[model samples]
Target: MARPNLTRPNATRPDAAGPNAAGPNVHRVQPGASVQAAVDAAHPGDVVELAAGNYPGSVTIATDGVTLRGQGNRSVLVPDPADHSACAAAGNGLCVTGVADDRGMPVRPVSGAVVESLAVAGFAKNGIAAAVTDKLTVHQVASHDNGLQGISVEMSTRTVLTENEARDNGQAGIFVANWFDRKGGALETRGTQVAANRLTGNRIGLQLRRVRDLTATGNLASGNCGGIFVVGDDGVPRAGSLSIANNVVRANNRYCEPNPRLDSVQGTGILLTGTEDVVVSENLITDHSGTSPMSGGIVLYPSVVGAPNARAVVTDNILADNLPVDLADLDQRNGSSFMTNSCRTSQPAGHC
Candidate 1:
């Protein structure tokens, strides 16, 4: 689908230059100018462009229907020294969030926002985050070496993370979670897309904690702790109407956080912890060369997390099965189906 070019506003055709091409609604920030100030100054349908420089402090975007465009990697934001004593300030580099009321409930939602062409790194939490927002788009951004997820959508619906590069983050590169710990309610993600992204050297490439209508496609993941983690074990419902298709996942379990509970380090091409009704199809799952039985082409951790993952379809995948097991449905959760899979070893011929 063709998105409206925020640069032209009324123009039906998308302009290649976007808001950077210069217009009345475009605000340019110099090296030391505060990005948050520019966002505060911008109105709806406005764009704030950051010039190339190292900025300090978290940039809060309380505005709605705005675009924050950085000058590629040249625009960097470090942790706010005031917020923390050290570099890890525990705040998002660029935060698109709404205001809260007296009871700490969100009274407003910062919707229809876009953060593009920024190299977001360092300073505590996610490189870019949207909390309780809707229709947010993150495009052509390079987020790496952050404290947490490179890009995070927490309690946000209708979000898109596209053409982004996430690497060397402390946590998952791209994370879509309900933030139930903070919000505490029944969660249902609707209309979320994670496409054409490259995630590497992170704890997990793409971690989907809980989502209903989720689509993750045409992404590349490698040399991470894991790849394509479909998790919803704690208290969230199993993910339904989800699709993880046409992705390249390999060389995971490369870095394992030492934990006493698990005796071995484990990772997989696709780790379906406690998700159901998910269609994992047309993915090239291969070369998961790790020692842990948990590390394989495809893994299903049943009964270990939430109500055992049931009613899933694993089909049309190329599995190298280099690890201990290619696909493990050992407990065989009810309605666990498999079909049309090609594997080098450790898989039955018949479809399950």
Candidate 2:
């Protein structure tokens, strides 16, 4: 498939030289300056550039075709005790949201926004939160030590999250959902891509909840309670039609206590629950060992709401040393198949 030509806002690095160094479209903010002020003053095609220093406040981007960039990891955003912005009040380090309806669904998505090359930490909620956005690109950022997801996107389409680092977040390193506050059927993401990222030490590395038409590829996940999770429930248009490929998942044995919604998570590499028409292929999974019911290399299990997975294809993967088994298809209602996988053991045997 041909790659789509994603729209990008005008951007300039903080250290660039020559005529484009500080163009008229660039809004530069120093350490103590207000990033929100610069963002508010920017036009649709403008770039809001942050200098290499600590910025102590949350920032919200509602304008279209804007880019918020920083000087690599040296540009840091932390929570501010005195800030009263809606994003700060929501405990998010950075937020991009469009106009919403009465039901809190976006009527018009924020379009063509890019966020890159910064570090966001120590927030009470998600580090980077994007809701109802279209064609958003998040690249080369470091998000860690947040109370919730490191980077989260909900009800977004054509979003690209690539080459970022998410570590030690309280929840999933990267989370994508149809809706965070309500229970509903899967929403099509229109080719959202999560690729080439590094995820470690979070409760879950990457989680896809009630969403479809997305791809997670070329990622590395380890030291999390679970490497990757594709979850659905009893809702209509259930989560499926996605691809998980070319990922390196290893030793996701970090123990996490059971939450109200599910059991304890540990030693889970790739888990698919209540999903259908999903493809799991070309992954390297190893060394995930635990006694948890979800532990394994590649697992197909029933959802929390007792919906069984169907029509899942697990093929051409390499797996080793996973506890209980390398492949476990515990779903009773079966349309799932495991073929041509290189593994030692399986739950019902002969899958390898």
Candidate 3:
């Protein structure tokens, strides 16, 4: 399927007055009120405007074209242990779920759902989680201190996650995956974008796993165990066809213990594994120094499942002060090349 235009119109702004503004179509909820009730009662193209206060409990959005807007970061959403809503029960602060198959793959994605200008923190799982949603826009939200991901999108396409602040999360600040619990071939994201976000103090700043046809650009990632990770596996269709460009990734030197899926990670910047046809260009990766095997600038390692990267293009990046080497092509897969990168050192001796 062709990708939809991900831009939002001015009329969709929180202050905009339209047929759905400040009336029956717009549902305003105060701090103690139920956000879920307004969400449930909303029709398509309606706005659920939240007042500037702390809202407890979790809410779920299943309806299409619903805009959940808040008064900037002053509107905060926190966990309510006593609230047994499905979103809270699942340990997510806010969830947008759509029709899925028995295997948990999206069959019919929720369309035109927006979540913006709010803060969500201290959730056991993700701050904001979306599964099987298309053209889902999450912007200007502050997601921090979540147990899992700050913002997670899975089995979805055409997602726009821009201008968000994600920090101090246990896992990736922003995570995009085909499926979290299952193994499969890479899904085609059809122009999903992760752009212009500030990410710090997470295990990994950003992670793109088992997905293709995506772009991650103009972001700042620092102070994490790893800056960015593009991971694929032995699954068919293999993750690739993506662009990682024009980003600043630096000083990801925090030490994170080995998890069930990965070894101890620290001081890594832009690690790409088991992917094909990926472009890593115009990024400033610097000041990452650690003893871990994965530590370096633009390191390409084999995937966890031992699949090697192929046909990757590493070009036009400014790399400096990375430990072990600036560019380490540990995979040395076929048809991969490094050219025109301004870096001091590399494992193979002459790629720089």
Could you give candidate 1's per-residue lDDT for residues 265-330 as a string of tens digits? 455788776677888999988778676656778776652443567688889988874577677665
Candidate RMSDs in order: 4.9, 3.9, 3.9
Compared with the true structure, what per-residue lDDT tens digits does model 3 show for residues 218-289? 999999999999999989899999999999999999999988878789999999998999999999999998
For candidate 3, which ten residues in a row score worst on lDDT?
1-10
Question: What range of 10 consecutive residues in model 2 has the weakest lDDT sum?
Answer: 1-10
- Candidate 3 TM-score versus the reference: 0.94
Q: Which of the predicted structures, 1 or 2, would earn the higher lDDT when compared with the native?
A: 2
TM-score preference between candidates 1 and 2, better one: 2
Candidate 2 — which residues are off by over 4 angstroms?
1-24
Q: Give the TM-score of candidate 1.
A: 0.86
Quickly count the clashes in candidate 3.
0
lDDT of 2 by residue, 144-168 (tens): 9999999999989999999999999
